[model samples]
Target: MMRMFLAAAPAVLLALSSAQAEPVAYEFDLSHTEVSASWVHQGYSRQSLQFTDFDGTLDLDLETPANSTVDITFNLISGIWAGAHHEAFVGHLNSGDFFDTAVSPTAHFVGTSFETEDGETGVMTGDLTMNGQTHPVSLEVTLNNSGETRDGRSKLGFTATGTLLRSQWDMGYAVPYVSDEIDLFISTEMAVPAPAE
Candidate 1:
């Protein structure tokens, strides 16, 4: 009995430590956030697009980083292409050729797993739902900076990048000519609201 207890001690301690770790909740700062993408156009130039509206929540567990979570939603029709043919580009993106925003106006991402090295560089895996389709995706993230605001609100800043094949979502569009792979990039600041007085 004594030997068995000794052997189980470490596991019990680990469980206790994990149970004591709590995740910090954060609200995204929409005004300073950008969820954007880019891709090679006709194998000649790169074109960029940005989602005009998006919101999300993040739970960061400093003690056990893998316990972190992120949930986000994007307005599909809000995508804006940055070029001279902006209006035409946006219209095409919202049509059946791409997102088909009429039937699927919203896209979402819910993180399933998270891991970090040195608590600053990390990879988050999640299911990305777009145009009524869902696929597993991974984002490489870096904690650029973090601190408390002047008013004592906790803040975190980070940037993440990922890539997805548009064809996987039935959005083949122009395929090889327009490029099937889309690169995603997100940079934002999040703040934790102060507790009620």
Candidate 2:
């Protein structure tokens, strides 16, 4: 009986180790990432805005998807308009009427939970902090691809979309005129960094 108990110990420890697998860490590939938003312009057309500077990190647990986590930070001053009147429009957006970037030059998001059915697509819920306000937001996310690159680097790509009310963050300057609802679109690629010598 003593011998049998000792023999089972090794198997039990192995099982525990496998169950506690650590997640893979990845950093945003900034060159391949894009974060942007769009809103209706007085019921006529949808005006677009893009944020150029940001940083993000991801901890992916493929074995247990629920353990995955993500975080992102955007520089509000990097906001840019898409069409004509780019300079003036972006300047106004940075003013108190819209983003009020002068007071809050940065926005941040931290994923609190990740829910998925097929592993390829799912919903991510998190808190978004912008313009001195924090609010819960949900994003529909889709995994574009994941694999090793030609240089032997592990990488993954994803796309996400969501919507938020401008008033929630107290940035409802235009409201019905520029549309209170803002649509968010994001596409990004993340990669594991190489070890330094």
What TM-score does structure 1 among the candidates reach?
0.82
Residue-level lDDT of model 1, residues 90-197, one tens digit each, is 888889988889999888777776655455666667778888889887777776677777899867677777788889989998889988888888777777777889
lDDT of 2 by residue, 127-189 (tens): 788888898877777777776667787777777788889899888887779898888887776
Q: How displaced is residue 144 in candidate 1, in Å?
A: 0.7
| Model 1: residue 37 alpha-carbon error in angstroms | 0.4
Candidate 2 deviant stretches above 4 angstroms: 1-20, 79-84
- Error (Å) of candidate 2 at residue 143 is 1.0
lDDT of 1 at 102: 95
Clashes of each: 0, 0
Score every model by TM-score.
Answer: 0.82, 0.83
